[model samples]
Target: MIKFLLIVNRQGQLRLRKYFEEKVVTHGEQREIIRQCLSAVDKQNFLVEFKDFTVVYKKYGNLYFIAGITSNENELAVLELMHHMVETLDKYFDRVSEIDILYSLDRVHMVIDEMVVNGYILETSQPRILVPLQLLDVARK
Candidate 1:
């Protein structure tokens, strides 16, 4: 199961964080991890093994979309999920960017929730994930 997800920018600033399990971590610890992630030389290395968890990340433009999971989890599946998430966002916002995400954080959060429920991955279908968002958008009008 996935533990947490973190989206950070090129400057090592965290853009979004979602914790599936209850884990109390200090700001300093998170900052240290961000520092290491930002300083990584091999951008192609998608999996980074930490002490307690493994991180799977993909660099998208200036943002790094990451998933933190246990050692026993499926690395490839998580990586695919991350890519699917980016593609879903791109379709929703006509090419997603940091500015677009910041402007429509609610939509992003909704999409995330649709894709993952209680830390477990749901469906990979774009239409399945966007159903809620589409319904909400229709209702708002």
Candidate 2:
């Protein structure tokens, strides 16, 4: 399958964005892996135009939230492939415990869940987490 990824170079300047025609030998591997990738980049309660961390997946686009010299752009490859999501995440690399961490879908999801729970929110989807908005609202109440 032709998968694309967005990766930020060592310079932290939205420099890398490319279409990777990665071939998956195993059946359904691409779908599953993509799900995982999205999961890694996932963060719940990331509202658009909020001037904070976010990650979004469109039909074939990306929207970067953290827009500055010190943005968490390690997912440059993922951002290039899909709509860049999440911004203002520099603290991930600034904090003592978060600095040494690697950004992945699972990690993102966990952090997002924690934040939402901390903020007293019921739950949130990754803009494209499979769960429909209508359902989410029902669950929220």
What clash count goes with each model? 0, 29
* Tens digits of lDDT, candidate 1, 1-141: 898888889998788888888863467867777777777899677877776888788888999887888888899999888999999999988899998878788898888898988888998899989888889889999
Clashes counted in candidate 2 amount to 29
- The Cα RMSD of model 2 versus the native structure comes to 15.9
On the 0 to 100 scale, the lDDT of residue 130 in model 1 is: 85
The 10-residue segment with the lowest total lDDT in model 2: 61-70
lDDT of each: 0.85, 0.31
Those runs of model 2 whose alpha carbons end farther than 4 Å from true positions after fitting are 1-85, 94-109, 116-141
The residue-level lDDT of candidate 1 at 63 comes to 93
lDDT of 2 by residue, 1-141 (tens): 213323332223232233323321233532332343344444542222212322333321232222111124333433332331232122332331222223433444433343233223233334443234335447879
Candidate with maximal TM-score: 1
In candidate 1 the C-alpha lDDT for residue 139 amounts to: 100
For lDDT, the strongest prediction is: 1
